[model samples]
Target chain A: MTEVTEPAIETVTIDVVLSALADPVRLTFVRALDAAGDWTCGSDVLRETGVTIGKSTLSHHIKVLRDAGLIRTRVDGIRRLVTLRYDEVEQRFPGLLAMLREHGPARARGISSPYTSG
Target chain B: MTEVTEPAIETVTIDVVLSALADPVRLTFVRALDAAGDWTCGSDVLRETGVTIGKSTLSHHIKVLRDAGLIRTRVDGIRRLVTLRYDEVEQRFPGLLAMLREHGPARARGISSPYTSG
Candidate 1:
């Protein structure tokens, strides 16, 4: 099992975090991760969020999220597990996750989502 | 007096807003505007926030913020008055301004601010 590395709570900056989440795909992914506990870099999340993208695109979004310290990804044998650093991010920048939960990407974009519309 | 123009609350997107505020300088400017209310596109805000930048750069940042719908800028005779779209942003994306208020750019960057230190 590989180690999970992310920015420390104290070292996390709002700018980096917001920049990471500025993408619509990443925002959808983060909100999905927030709603659900942990997800794998698989087609399940894609189907769940109704996001149509290739494997490379998903990988890029995952990398961006992890690099920004918003998500934690660790290799578990052959599978890569991903989880949102919800509490830690909230500690560093309060009200951020709560806002994401309350006002999701769908609402922000003025469009309904598969996750919310259902 | 020039008319104030901005993206309507319904048309405002989180990605644009986040992208605009992702810049450290712009984040500082928004926070300053939030705390101090209306400010001008002049030297006073530069002195208040301790951000040293040329007029063109400030104007550029102001344009980005305005284009992102995070702020409303209007011309009052010779002065270009700028104000944070605090309530409008809150209405569009709740908890964002509150988060900025609780975790300012200084705190987000893990630095002490002249405004807060004093």
Candidate 2:
């Protein structure tokens, strides 16, 4: 059994959380995790988000989020399940995740640019 | 008169805003600006936040925030006045600055760590 590590919710900083979520793919992952609970690595989550990236890249992004204390990863046999620390993060940063949940999908869709036509 | 550049509010992306605010000093700046409204660079805002950073470093952080579209800067005589684009940011990603305004001070005070004593 591989032991997964994560910081306590109170230990997380807004700075670290912001840094973790600064990437497009990771933001998409968090939005997905918020909408649909526990997600397995290399699952349909990526496909659902419409993001094209290598498996190693996705794993790296997950590692960053885990290190930032915004997520929990557990090993269920050979598969690793990822869960967003939504409530914990909300306790620490209040409305951060709610804002992400509301606006993140439009960002992930690359429609955040003002120059782009609707 | 030096020209100050910033992205239009609609051009701002949540990712850039998060990256801009990931730093402690920058976060403090935004929080202060949010609380006090228009602030002049090189003013007592730093003293208020209790952050000890140099002038050049502070300028760099301000530039990051400005480029990220989280702030608007205008040259007011010799002083560069900085203002949080509060409404614009709120329009782009609702609840983001409100979250920062609500919880940012605690994070700035270095009390975000669970290991720290209250």
Q: lDDT of all the models against the reference?
A: 0.76, 0.75
Expressed as tens digits, the lDDT of each residue in A13-71 for candidate 2 is: 67778878877788878877887755555456776666799988888888999999988
TM-scores for every candidate against the unseen true structure: 0.77, 0.74
Please write out the lDDT profile of model 2 over residues B1-118, one tens digit for every residue.
Answer: 4989899887776777887887778887887788776555545677666678888888888889899998888888878888888788888877788777655554344534321121
Q: Which stretches of candidate 2 lie over 4 Å from their true place?
A: A42-60, A105-118, B1-5, B47-54, B105-118
lDDT of 2 at B36: 73
- After the best TM-score superposition of candidate 2, give how far the Cα of residue B71 lies from its true spot, in angstroms: 1.5
Per-candidate DockQ vs. reference: 0.50, 0.43
Which run of 10 residues does model 1 chain A get worst, by summed lDDT? A109-118
TM-score of chain A of 1: 0.80
Cα distance off (Å), candidate 1, residue A60: 4.4
Q: Candidate 2: RMSD over Cα atoms?
A: 6.7
> Each candidate: RMSD to true structure?
4.2, 6.7
